[model samples]
Target chain A: MSDNVVPMKRTGEATPSLSPILSLTATAMNSVNQVILDRMQSEIPLIPALAGHLISGGGKRMRPMLTLAGAQVVGYQGTRHHKLAAAVEFIHTATLLHDDVVDGSETRRGKSAANIVFGNPATVLVGDFLFSRAFELMVEDGSLKVLKILSSASAVIAQGEVDQLTAQRRIETSEERYLDIVGAKTAALFAAASRIAAVVAEREDAAERALDDYGRNLGIAFQLVDDAIDYDTGTADMGKDRGDDFREGKMTLPVILAYARGDEEERRFWQDAIAGFRIDDADFAHAVALIRRHDCISATRERARHFAQRACDALSIFPDGAARRAMVEAAQFAVSRGY
Target chain B: MSDNVVPMKRTGEATPSLSPILSLTATAMNSVNQVILDRMQSEIPLIPALAGHLISGGGKRMRPMLTLAGAQVVGYQGTRHHKLAAAVEFIHTATLLHDDVVDGSETRRGKSAANIVFGNPATVLVGDFLFSRAFELMVEDGSLKVLKILSSASAVIAQGEVDQLTAQRRIETSEERYLDIVGAKTAALFAAASRIAAVVAEREDAAERALDDYGRNLGIAFQLVDDAIDYDTGTADMGKDRGDDFREGKMTLPVILAYARGDEEERRFWQDAIAGFRIDDADFAHAVALIRRHDCISATRERARHFAQRACDALSIFPDGAARRAMVEAAQFAVSRGY
Candidate 1:
């Protein structure tokens, strides 16, 4: 880690933690959790069956927590954010279901993916159900502005997914393109999830934009660390398989940076590996070695630190309080999470 | 055909036609088509490429036509329905793309399905893009009422689809249950698309309810005819493969009726076929033969005629004129389509 990186805390010896966030939003999150459980049920038994499989699994519920935390940061006292927070979680869950199907994932959150357990058809339909349910929750809130933000973010996410699919297996993908995909597919929802809190709080535009910035930067930093961990063989498995990105030919930041920094011989190996010619465990080991040789994993983490620092900075507008501090620590935790 | 069935028209010399509805909505449909083409585009090339493969395919834009025709029936002068109509079409297209993937179908609208032309990953992602885009369109129109109707309908449709999946391969499925599935998955969208026009028109509650009934019954009738056609060997291939329902073990109305009316030996045969133990062409032929002997195709179409007549009657509250006649005829056509 670099000295320029943001510290986990200004006064404590502890590492950055989500404990403050979890505690800060714990009571409100119960209401949000109730909304999620209530809305996910349907007369169609399979809809709830498939949705509950993933939702009841040990997901972090990070997106909805952002909504709740964002509300506290803005000093909003209303209960409106509870339902809205649940909507955010529903959207995130829907995205995960589709993502697992798209990636053909076997395990998620230390268990079989919904697609694996229910089969792809049921998984996809339940995802659609949850997505539509998200919109229903928003419409119940009756905020046109919130609807616009979330619906637009949803479109951007799909575009990013398609763009990433296009870039898959293409060895020549640039860091810029990878970052753009991360911004859309991951950060857009995070941004929306945080921003909606400001809207419900009746906060000024400045506060809204600040929350958006906080979530977006934190999301990018989070994704960068995730991509780094895929190649970090030293780390324990984090829910998903370690080399999923490698086997799927995802042009993640570490892969992009490694290819950029490689010699002619190393470049040849990357081309073969990224083009789906190399996917064995030995190939993954070699890929990780190449990434480590170029110090790309640390490089990726360094970039994550920059974003995490910005995420903390974006909270400066709010008064120095536990809520803002918790969010800031959460952002730091996002980057330093695996390592 | 039964003696009590609804005739093609009040007068002889022509079968019921979509021509009236088509011509009535023709000019406004151009605008909807433009919106669909423009909005479906993305920086990700594969999105529009995959979407267009299905969009530009020669399928009739039936649902959007409902919106436009409903607008005409209610004398809605504003052009807002144009965008809403496109939104309906986008939802329908998204469903079709997912349906093809779920069914593992090889063709749609007589061309290769988007899933077949593009891979399933791209197809599913493009479907997501279109669905999100549909919401974006609705949000842009800034009508919470319209959003509520469509979003609620979407949730119901997903529930219905999951229900149908649950019903698949279970030969004991009842006609009442099948009808319920059709009402949710097919008729709900129809109801929403037509009702939104009245909402945008700022019409009375009665008018809105009338439009909903018109659309819902019409949708049910449309689905009944489609299900009947799958068993109709005398019918020309209607863009989809004949006996797909049989092979997929879907217990449509024809199968339900044939099974109910069947003797012990025939019941055993259906049990084997619907359980996927029999899937060859000869098995499908036997299934169709049993259906024909039991006169179940006509029975299914007879149910379609009842719904179509109800659909036509729902429009009776509107003034007697071209729009009303066209809608009525469209309902008639829905029931008689595959015959």
Candidate 2:
């Protein structure tokens, strides 16, 4: 490990921020964004139109930033990761497009979902176009290693999605199973995205594993926080239609925790609501009250905080500087969203 | 070209059949089936369950058979094409799953479609899993050439699907546009599957291009005959729900031909039907009558015969032998399916 100083958050600082990582990756992201825009185009007008709707949407580009930052942390000077990073974003966007269709989502990133604007058939097909384009990009890069990572992660994501569908209105879904789904559907891509950075930089296996662990834990934290914000009612910057999970009868962590701790009466209410019996505004209000009473949101964020810290700690083996500090702070910022 | 004899169809013999190709590819296809069964397995039970619904639904494994037969034509002795053939089938199966979802298909291969049995969410996600698995298999094969062919074909297939969707309700969809969509969505994969056989054999580019032409023409004939069968009252062994294109407003060649040949009153009926107004059994029956009056189904089959002949001619450069004869017979069988 290098003998450079690792920056820590100031004692009693106002809040953790994402600016460090944002500025650190700003220049690199422009190249990645160009690749993304160029690659998403196709002869079919609908392919580019629907893909652009989501690509231009205000996503954080958080996953690719991990790749860029991890590259910086390893002192790599090559520009190949720009295309790789764009491929990562394409994979992510493809999943999001499919997710909206599966969920019958009304809005995404605070706008009408692609499925809504373009219809599900076009949406699904465009998602496929983007996915195939992702592989094409990886093939052009000629990295069997990256192809394996991304392809395996993609399968895991789809499997996780199916698993989540199986667990969807069951009401008996365990936190373990929920976490498994989170790891597969959400964190698998995260881990792959971060791990590819080390591979592109030609770093050691230890560095790759370190970045994988960091990304996986950070992804879990990020998903947990998103789940928390869904029911928090205090978060006004909702990027999707609120109460969508509740209406769709998704067995997320908040519901799982609340149900695990509910009394017989409260349990009956949850059982009814989760079984698709109660879904009006009043029912959602009651569900929110039950969750807040059990402090499940806080418990969920507490879990997120644990993973975010683990993400930061994963960076310690690398040289400490702006790159390391930015990545560490980005982890903190991931958990701080919707606060 | 070797001095081997190319078998021509015997005059005064029985109709051309798929038996030659079936016998030619039977052994190798068993190995390909093994790979497909092995790879389609996943930790998520729903994936295999849903995927198996379509895989075992008794549809002929026509695309992979093309790969195996093309390998024989090229005299490839290796077992690598088995995995690659399975990869081709996986891509085909993935697209079928997504197509059923997109078209809201109720029956596939004369049984309940996967979406009908397993729900759309699982169907879509499993399709994604299988698609990723296809890429994984190709990556394991470690041929960048094969990857490029398959990936580019996949992108074209997706684009074709989107193009077809855009043309769905437009009664003015011309024969040219319909052919373009069919080429991309169906023939592209067929071409890729056949070409990969030459790629793995390390054959000359001439052999690859010839095989590609063979597959592409056969695929067009296959799909054209399928569209013809949908409207032909004389045909019995329909694979999917009849009139699905009619009900869903898909602009296939049959519809385009009938519309093009219709009178003013007939044209209005066609327009209304294509625009989703006329969809009852009576309307479908009347539509069939009008199509028959125009001899659209026969015209469509004439078109198919032209392509099938081209498919057979494309294989002429190869030595005429059992492999060549089997593939040529397979093309004839493809166009003769619903007769």
Candidate 3:
């Protein structure tokens, strides 16, 4: 995973280099992350106790950075931006805890998952705690619009999770349905975070929509990349066991698309592997090879790039500032990062 | 268990002449229950498919009735009362679904539990959907105060559940801690329902306090009775298996208090049954005998009655109206009903 951290630029882009933007983003994110950690430690003491092991176990804090960067790009100067950033992190943490429980994941980021450490009941209830605490923090912002956006997003995300659970291992699941699930479960929060920042900054409607669009597109790109990496990357690169999604019968985008295009033998393998849950190592390897042979990985990666480009397009409406430049760079970084 | 139904007076006073009040309360509850079924059916089109299964699966709907009675007693004439009542029911239903999943409960209300039918993931996520839908209904009321109350209660209830999970099976759990958990997890919503009714009715401060106290005390009594029934009732009587609390390692008030007063043998029985998870039918019977011999069942019953009396006390501050009389009767019913 560490070996995949490339510099934040494409090799052939003729756009002027923006090193200062990256530096500003890093500085802003550092302060925002600190605020988030401190608030999480104080407000949800149990979270720090439970998540401390995992926090140190390592995560990129990418969501917090997105929020902070989004706020900064729109010229947000108030300290409330810090609170919003922390709220974003809390929401993300809550979802991760619940997701691991739902997935029955034993390891996350190469460390024992929360459910593995504290048990599923503790992991689930604590996840509820973080979600509630996130709402309390959002309420403190005193923006009804922000509250509405966040509350609605949370509802959508939860529904999306249920939709995925219902669709798991179902041979009838389509790529469009898979994308819809991803959009609600993963992208809604990202979009809410970015849009809330713009709302807090009191940006014009167009700017708010642009930032929201940027976040929505970036979130889709990020999730697609994640799904694609599950097939292309090894366990060492992904920091967890590879092919667990297929083993668990989850119909991710690549799997759904590949199954749609497979030959009779390949299709039978896919059905037995996912639908029948006959996911031996050889079958996992076969599914991976089948996805690659079907050009699903490259196709999915291209789809991610398309969304990344759309994310960049949303920023065109923004003034040329350090934050705007960083936003553009971050979208590209999202696509370029290895699984 | 049916034979043991304590035939205490329907009113806390030494009078059996409160039959009118009981009948009025019953009629009001019947109407409210119908409204609840209608609204739940209207909103969930899948109700026809699932309602018979869920409704026949038997729940007391105590929380929803509390909401309706609370609103009626506060003189709220608006149609929003029904929505609030349904909101309470939805929240309660959500909790029950999640509770069954967390406890791995196979039976509820003398039938197969939802998780036993739909699987754990579905139960958990559907529970989440109910909660989200509850919030959506609350938002439609357009009362930020109600939203705030319900939201805070939701958070506190979830936190209480987490606290219970962390403290489960710990022999060191105290009665005070147990009370805290029951108050937050069970009574908080009850209090919120009544308090929100007052807020909606724009009542006087004294009236609001009276209703809030009534609801809180009623909730405490309700939970106390529930805990006691775990020892005194069987599956056929209680609609679910007895000794479930013990099996789940939950440290209810009676158990905590009993453990404090237990002899060495009894203490060992509890330790093995709960903390060590070595419970058997023999252990359950032994535990029941110990509880009876120690008079813990009677002691717990007295405490429940005390809370019921306190609930009636809150109503003395209200006017001599039918609603107030019904509220008083309901409290008595909660404590003295089929044991």
The best-first sequence of candidates by lDDT reads: 1, 2, 3
Best-to-worst order by DockQ is: 2, 1, 3
Q: Give per-residue CA lDDT, model 3, range B282-311, as digits (tens).
A: 778888888888888778878888988888
- Where model 2 places Cα greater than 4 Å from the true spot, the runs are A1-8, B1-10
TM-score per prediction, in order, is 0.97, 0.97, 0.88
Which candidate leads the pack in lDDT?
1
Q: Is the docking of candidate 2 incorrect, acceptable, medium or high quality?
A: high
Clashes of each: 0, 2, 1
Report lDDT (Cα) of residue A314, candidate 2.
82
TM-score of chain B of 2: 0.97
How do the residues B274-302 of candidate 1 rate in per-residue lDDT, one tens digit apiece?
Answer: 99999999999999999999999999999
- Which residue window of length 10 is worst by lDDT in model 3 chain B? B42-51
Per-residue CA lDDT of candidate 2, range A46-163, in tens? 7878999998988999999988988898888999999999999998998999998898898999999999999998889998998999999999999899999999999999999999
Instruction: Give the per-residue lDDT digits (tens) of candidate 3, residues A199-299.
Output: 88888898789888989998998899888888875434758577878888988888888988888888888888878567888888888889988999888
- Stretches of candidate 3 exceeding 4 Å from the true structure: A1-48, A55-57, A234-236, B1-56, B234-236
**Model 1 agreement with the true structure over A1-339: per-residue lDDT tens digits:** 433343445765588889999999999989999999999999988888899999999888999999999999999999988888888888889889988888999999999999999999988888888999999999999999999999999999888898999999999999999999999999999999999999999999999999999999999999999999989989877786799999999999999999999999999999999999999999999999999999999999999989988888888888877898799889879887888
Q: What is the RMSD of candidate 3?
A: 5.7
